[model samples]
Target: MTVTLAADSGRLPEYPMELDSAQSQRVERLLAGTVISLHDHPIRLPDPLTAETWKLHSGQSADVFGGDAIVRSGLNVVLASALAEPDQRRLLSWAAAMRPQLLGPELSGAESLALAMRGEGSAVLLALEDLGSIGTDLVGIEELYRAGFRSAGLVYNTGNALGGGLGQSTDGGLTEPGRRAVAMLNDLHMLVDLSHVGDRTSIEAAALSTAPVVISHAGARSLWPSARMKPDDVLRAVADTGGVIGIEAAPGSTRVSADTTHDLDAVMAHVEYVAELVGVDHVGLGPDTFFGDHTQLYSAAGWSPQPVPGYERLALPDYVAGMENPAEAPRNAASWLVRRGWSDADIAKVLGANAARVLESVLR
Candidate 1:
C-alpha cells in the first residue's frame, strides 16, 4: 500500500532543542555513562526493491558511531525479508557473505565486557530482525549463530512458517514450529525480540521463552496506536519476563498524536509512557535509525508507514529531529530525559544499563 506523503517532505528542523546551562551539564554527565542502543541499523541501507544486489553505503561499520558513548549496539539485519523467492534469497546470500567484512571483528561476551571496562567501546553485536532467512530449520539458525548473531525476532511484520506477524490482517499467533523455534533460540542463548510480531504471537513467545524477551525497537500502542507499536498487554508480558522495550524514534512510528511534530519530543513521549507503565528498568533506547532520510527509503521501497486499524495515519516527517540517525540519537535521547528532570539513575537505566543487563544475561 502506498502511504501518501505529507506536504512538508523537506528536512524537518535539526536538533530543535535549547537546553539551559544546568540541563546541558546534565547531558554531558550522562554521555560519560555506558550508553547502549538495543536496536539500530547503524549501517546505511540501499533501497532493496531498486538494488540489483545487496550493497551498503561505503564506510567501516565501527567508524559509524565514532567516539559515541554507546558501548554496545544491537545491529539488526533489517533488510532481510520474509519472502521466499529466488531473487530475494540470492540477495540474502550475498548479504550473509558480506557480513563478516562489513561488521569487522566479532567480540565474545567476555571480550566485549573487558573492552567496556577498559573504557574502550565494545564491538557491535549482530541480530536478525526475523528468522525469515532460515525458514523453519534449526540448522539455518545454527549457521547464523555461528556467524555471530546473538539475537533474532521470530517474525517480521508479516507471517512466516514460524508464525503470524503484525502486518497480517488476521493473526493466528505462534505455530507448533514457532514454539519449537523459540525453545531453540533459548537453548542457543539467542536474545528474542518481538518488535514487529502480531500481538498474540508476541505475548505467546514471551510466555514460552525461557530467556527475557524484548520488543527491541518499538513504542506503546496506547500512545501512538500504530501496528508497529506494542499494546499494553504485550508490554506487560515483556516486562513480566524481565525484558526491556527499547523505544524507537523512526519518523511517524512513535508520535504522541496524529498532528504532533515527529521529533525527539515525540520519541520521548513514548519513552515516558513506557517507563511509567512498566518502570524505568523495563525501558531503553532502540532508535532504529540510520544515516539517511528514512522516509525516502520507504517511499523508494514502496513501503507504507506502519498504521493500525483504528488510528488515523501519521504524517511523515522528513526526518525525526535530534533522533535522525544513530550518531545523534543516543546523546539526544539521554539529553531529552535529562531535560525532562528524570533522575540520573533512571536515565542511565533507560539509556543503557537496562538493556545491558538483559543482553548480558542471554549472551552469557
Candidate 2:
C-alpha cells in the first residue's frame, strides 16, 4: 500500500461537523491554552522496555519523587502488565530465579515498598500480562477488562494462541480464538492494539472490531518498510474507524540509524507520512524511548535468544538526541512541527490531543 501527498499542504479538517463553530473555537482555545513547559517530568506511560532498561543502565536508585513527577506531567494513566499484584510478584520471582545477578540490591527493596504503598501514587498502571506464552482462554483477560484493561493486543512479536506476530516464523492471521478474543474485547469496550500483531492479524482485527482500534506505537512503511510499521491499507483502515496510530522513536520502528544528525528528521518523515495517509487526527506519538539498557532484560527474560544486533546498546538518547527525557519529547516534536510549517493547533493535536481523543472514545 502506497500513500502519497501533495507538497506544501495546509492543515486538515479537525473533526465531524457535529461540533458547531463556537464549540470548535472553544475546544481549540482550551487546547491552545496548554503551555508546553520545559520541566523534566517522570514518564507516566508504561513502556516495558524502558522500565527494565532504566534499571539495567542506571543502577536502581530509588526515586521517592519519581511518582510525583509522573503526576505533575498530567500522565495519570499507565498501561503496564507487570505492576499488578500477581503479575508483579511473578515477575519479581522470575527475575530473582532466572537472573539474580542482574537484579540491583535496591530493586527488591523498592518493589517491596511500592507494593506496600500501593494506591498512594496518583497514576494508575494498568498491568497486563503477556498472554503470548499463556493459553488463549482469556479468562484472566476478561477479569482484567472488567477491572479495567482498556487497551490490549492479541500477541506481542511471537506466535500466540490468539494470533501470529511479525516475528513469528509463519505470518498467520487471527486464529479462531483470536477472532473470538477481538469480539469479546470489543464487546467489553477494550481497545484492541495492533502494534506487534502481524499484517494479517492487523487487517482482520481492524475489520472485526466495531470500534476503532489503534496500533499504539508504530511507523510508516513508506518511510521504512520494516516489520514494525503499518502498511498504508492498515493505516487507512484504522483511520476509517476513527482510530489513531502513534509513531514510535527511531530505534524501535524506523530504518533511520541512531545518528543524532538525521534521526529526528527520519522520525518526522514517518509522522508526516501517517498524517498524509490518515490526516492529523489519526497520527500521534507513542515513542517507546528506553532511558536505560533493555537488551539485558530481554536476554534475562529468555524472550530473545540473541541481543538486538546493532540495537542492543540503543537507549532513549539515540532516538531523540537532545530530548532524553519525557517532557523534552513534546517540546522537540512541537519545534519540529513548527519548522515543518505546522500551526500551533495542528502541533497540539500531534503531541497529545489526538491520543486523548482516541482514549476518551475507547476508554469511556
lDDT of 1 at 280: 89
lDDT of 2 at 6: 15
Candidate 2 wrongly placed segments (more than 4 Å): 1-65, 71-130, 146-148, 250-252, 257-262, 291-319
Candidate number achieving the greatest lDDT relative to the actual structure: 1
How high is the lDDT of residue 84 in model 2?
A: 14
How well is each residue in 63-162 modelled by candidate 2, as lDDT tens digits?
1123333334333233433321224234344333322222223232223224323423322323233345336666756655544335666677765778
For candidate 2, the lDDT comes to 0.54
lDDT of each: 0.71, 0.54
Clashing pairs in 1: none
Query: Which is the leading candidate under TM-score?
Result: 1
Model 1 TM: 0.83
Model 1 stretches with alpha carbons more than 4 Å out? 1-14, 45-104, 310-314
lDDT, residue 35, candidate 2: 22
Indicate the residue-level lDDT of 20 in model 2.
50
lDDT of candidate 1 vs native?
0.71
